[model samples]
Target: MSLMTTLMLAGGLLLLNGAAAPAETRVDLALVLAVDASFSMEPDEQDLQRHGFAEAFQSPEVHRAIRQGMLGRIAVIYVEWAGAFDQEIIVPWTVIEQPADGPAFAERLLRNPVHRMGYTSISGVIDFGIQQLRHSGLQADRQVIDISGDGANNTGRTVTLARDEALAHDVTINGLPIMLKRPSSLWDIEDLDLYFRDCVIGGPGAFLVPVREKAQFVEAIKAKIIREITDRSNPRSLIQPAHDALPTNCLAGELRRHQPTAR
Candidate 1:
């Protein structure tokens, strides 16, 4: 059977199995947190990236965030991506319906090995998240793609096209921009926040925040996610407003024809 067919059959079984039980299968709020693990993310930085998330789900804030969602539950996936084919789903779809379930899920995430890949294809990673959700089953109140990256679109598909595709289908794209030192290669892009705004974010009430430093990554990730799950009109925490900048890419003119996502 095709993957889609298998997923459908498996979901049917799960529904039947839970039907006789007292409680309903947990609400299916799905969040795809795509982390950038490109060459730019040094090993220690990557460890910090992983640790920040592990710590967040275990935090009181995240637990409270989960409870405040549409049905007091959400399922999440963690993927680390770099290059055109560097996508790896470190954690599969797991439900967090209670306080206890949250921490345990976070522990499983902590054990995954972090591999350093060399190129940064932000759109490649977004595409992977979109595909994962297609097989995720239509059992959720919302679908989200949260991406954290440190650079502009230097490879693979153009960032705007990817954002439009994701947002076109109501899949909100929130961004955590890891802006480090600028290199000659990313000349026109003065700040990653701009790249994320014009190219990486969309959907209902989409937002972007900056992980200004390694230490800030933990808090940034936690705060951003909490607001997302809670449907906060504005992030209760600080977030950088979008900074519009013309695509500084030398070949941007030729790529603009890629078309906005028609999803």
Candidate 2:
């Protein structure tokens, strides 16, 4: 080959190789805010849920937590899900390093329109979260799936299966069980927090914060995000240890949704 042609071919190969190897962003944590938008979550409750997450990102404590991380940065994605096949990415992976980035992230979350879909599928969201974490073009020291929902896994495969799979992949699962209203629906189960602790959350530092009232949304979300970001596993957050007997039926939602009179 001519010298000029050889140099051009070499440059072409270099460009092709570089194109095939995409750069990945490194951060302290990769957090998937997997929210629920099931039909059971009333419109007002959905509003509170969105506001809570938005305000949590805008909080001083959360900002401080992110800043204090070893890398001083974290990657986050917001997702909403319902049913086994219903999942939407409200916000793609974004890095938050400075104080301003927090609000910017919050703004992105708040700007999106809220959604309410049929059925609740905790397992679906968990599996979706795992996919996002693995494919997210970001390298992180930790990965977490934050689940906030009012109902249980009615339309998906077993919740524990998904939880265990994520744990096996070194991903922690956290919970914010919204219990503002009484468990009046067939899909709603009493002791939702216990359900989350025993069946949903697991990993090295897994914990859950139950939201029992409307007033606690913002603060509860803020505290949970801080704990996840700081990697502080407070046993107090869990109602009981993981090895203990399941406090509530892990399949209660599935059962209730299928057989309304089983309870």
- Maximum-TM-score candidate: 2
Q: RMSD of candidate 1 to the true fold?
A: 6.5
Clashes of each: 0, 0
lDDT of 1 by residue, 141-253 (tens): 78899998776655687767777888777798988888755543422245667667667788887888887777788888888888788867763534544643446353332
Question: Which stretches of model 2 miss by more than 4 angstroms?
Answer: 1-22, 238-247, 260-263
Question: Per-residue lDDT for 237 in model 1?
Answer: 32
Off by over 4 Å in 1: 1-28, 182-189, 235-263
lDDT of all predictions: 0.72, 0.82
The residue pairs in collision within model 2 are none
Candidate 1 has its poorest 10 consecutive residues by lDDT at 13-22
Model 1 lDDT on a 0 to 1 scale? 0.72
